[model samples]
Target: MPAAGSSLGKEVASSGDDLSKRLDRLEELVRSIAGDLRDVKQQQQGLGVAVLRLENRPKSPADNNAEVSANGVGATAEVA
Candidate 1:
């Protein structure tokens, strides 16, 4: 039969191994998340540029008059 101290030591060693593996898996997950975050930042930068370009574009008269015009006709025919 094994001594009580030796049995305790085996249990502690097995628990330590389990903890080490879990830590390694967590580290991998963290690295993957960091990469995803970098991609999101890059996409956000592109979207910001697109939004700025749209904002700087000239406004069309049609866009300005989405509602019925003062002449009581569809705005496009009135413009013509």
Candidate 2:
């Protein structure tokens, strides 16, 4: 019975060690993922700012020309 008890203790200790190692690996994985998410969030913010700038920018020369040509005065000016 003493030998059986010693074997049971060894098994318990082995399982506990395995559980600790797994927990450590899980913690490391979570930390790595969290870092990646932070980087992605920063990139997304930069993209958002760029999008906003594009949305609010002034029209190009082509757009201006189109607008002017839409009016009759622009064509008359070109002839003169």
RMSD of 2: 4.8
Model 1 TM-score on a 0 to 1 scale: 0.67
Q: Could you estimate the TM-score for every candidate? A: 0.67, 0.74
RMSD of 1: 4.9
- Please, what are the lDDT tens digits per residue for candidate 1 over residues 10-40? 9999999999999999999999999999999
lDDT (0 to 1) per candidate: 0.89, 0.94
TM-score of 2: 0.74
Q: Which residues of candidate 1, in runs, are more than 4 Å off?
A: 58-80
Model 1 accuracy (lDDT, Cα): 0.89
Backbone clashes for every candidate come to 0, 0
User: Cα miss at 30, model 1 (Å)?
Assistant: 1.0
